[model samples]
Target: MTSSTPLRIGVMGAHSTGKSLLMRRIEMELHGQGIPVARTGNLGRRAALVPLPKMQHHTLASTTWVIATGIADEIAAWARLEKGPVQVVLADRACWDALAYFRAALEWRQQTAPRAEREALHQLAHAHGRTYDLLLATVLDPDVPVESKHDYDPRYRTLVDRHTHDFLREENIRHVRVTSDPASQELAIEHALQLCMTEAPA
Candidate 1:
């Protein structure tokens, strides 16, 4: 809570869509390109306490916890920069990104979140999302194949990927969809840095 929130750019996508890859490269790209920006390490994977499917009866609770944790972490990161020279906060994942995964979890449970419950929770997420100036959404490349993660089954990754793509469009959140190509991750990082600088204060 300060006079101005740090310029936030959140990277979003499914498990293997290079969110972390971009997260790692953003700080370097900014510095290498001589763009002064502070960055937050990826908490998207680490913040999961009670996972979606595992929370069966308390799906809403788990969703709230995970999403809240994400926003809280982002805010904390921003606060850490108050006295520093950094003005832009490049975030790997955010509450909006959490919303995408939460939806995918709902589907995995074979149960729909009651409209009222879903709306209330998502409204909170959207409120937190207001701090973000840019959202870079990466898509899973068909040719690349989903990289294996111990926690993510191939089917679940696909499901989460579909929902993540749909949520951004359905919610009308302003975002740019970046495609990971057969060649390398550098393209994605360069593309993200380009988007971040669009409105970056620093």
Candidate 2:
């Protein structure tokens, strides 16, 4: 890829599934290969769109959702601007899944709202899916416990995971499933790198 058109690679999985760690590792590996890389987390802690009231109340979930969505929008804008081949862009979150999860959350909150809100959330979810270049599914071993203190409902977690996989399959996006093993993590990074390299312009 040229300096202007970076290959975007996304790493997605459940919270505390080593998504951040894997992203760091990928950066290191790409650097070793002399590849220029730009990396960002799926969700940022301090996104600007977070309402001041929500920040004052320490609304972790809302803040996270806003950050994640912001990153997606930002990346999509960047891709549109850089029309030539460029370095690699590795994102630690999957934008499409985040949109879906947020849509689910919004619908739950507006359970009593008019039908228009429901339709809007659905439209938003569909729009978000078209933003990403690829979706990486970071699979946690079923034995691993969900340890994040975040209040994501257990049922919601299950639903998002299933939906994420289904979305990737439907989009025909290249995905690498990283197991809990150390070797598997390395392999996953390698697989992602290969995908990035292949997509790069000759």
Candidate 3:
């Protein structure tokens, strides 16, 4: 099951939306099944520069560079190194999430940053959306608390979801929604694996 193109999957959602948990579960499940899987996430509290966890073995660049450069070259670089077919690369924060976060952050930055800098950031957000493959969105249950006040804006989450949907639809990328349920996570994982395996040599 060697693929010509890498299998890139993004587990994305707002704060405390269980994105990290889902990623961990998926990695464990895949590894248990003897699949080659790599999982990583934003381990730091600061969004400006978050590093991937050590368990994933991925050397992710700072979010600052991702925001500055419209292209997701860091992730792209890692994706190109598959020794065999069907290498699963899972990231907590993908280009889609980065775009969503950037859009939300834009409003706050607009109040302080110069006009040129604001425009550049917006362009970067758009570029991020164009580079992603699949987007797995997690819908949060109402009972969970926000990880941080800055990441808790319901309006931003809604807007980001809408934008994400548009990008997926426009690009024709596979997008799936998983509620805060273990069963749902299992189903999503199966579907995503099928897509990765069944897609044309990629």
Among these predictions, the greatest TM-score belongs to 1
Off by over 4 Å in 1: 1-3, 41-45, 48-58, 81-83, 145-151, 182-188, 195-198
RMSD of each: 3.3, 5.6, 6.8
Give per-model TM-scores.
0.80, 0.64, 0.62
Query: Model 3, 104: alpha-carbon shift in Å?
Result: 2.1
Q: Per-residue error at 174 for model 2, in Å?
A: 4.1
Clashing pairs in 2: 2-85, 2-86, 5-85, 5-86
Give all candidates' CA lDDT scores. Answer: 0.69, 0.58, 0.57
lDDT comparing candidate 2 with the true structure: 0.58
Among all windows of 10 consecutive residues in model 2, the one with the lowest summed lDDT is: 51-60
Q: How far in Å is the alpha carbon of 165 misplaced in model 3?
A: 5.4
Candidate 2 C-alpha lDDT tens digits along 1-202 = 2345566677666556678888898888887877766676634454434333221232325534554465665456345435543367777675554544443344434433347654554455446545455556776455777656865455555545555566567756666777678888888877777876677443
Cα lDDT tens digits for candidate 3, 68-173 = 3323443553465455444666766665565444444444334344567545645665565544456688775666556565534566555555554555566565
Clashes of each: 0, 4, 2
The residue pairs that clash in candidate 3, if any, are 2-85, 3-85
Find the candidate with the highest lDDT and give its number: 1
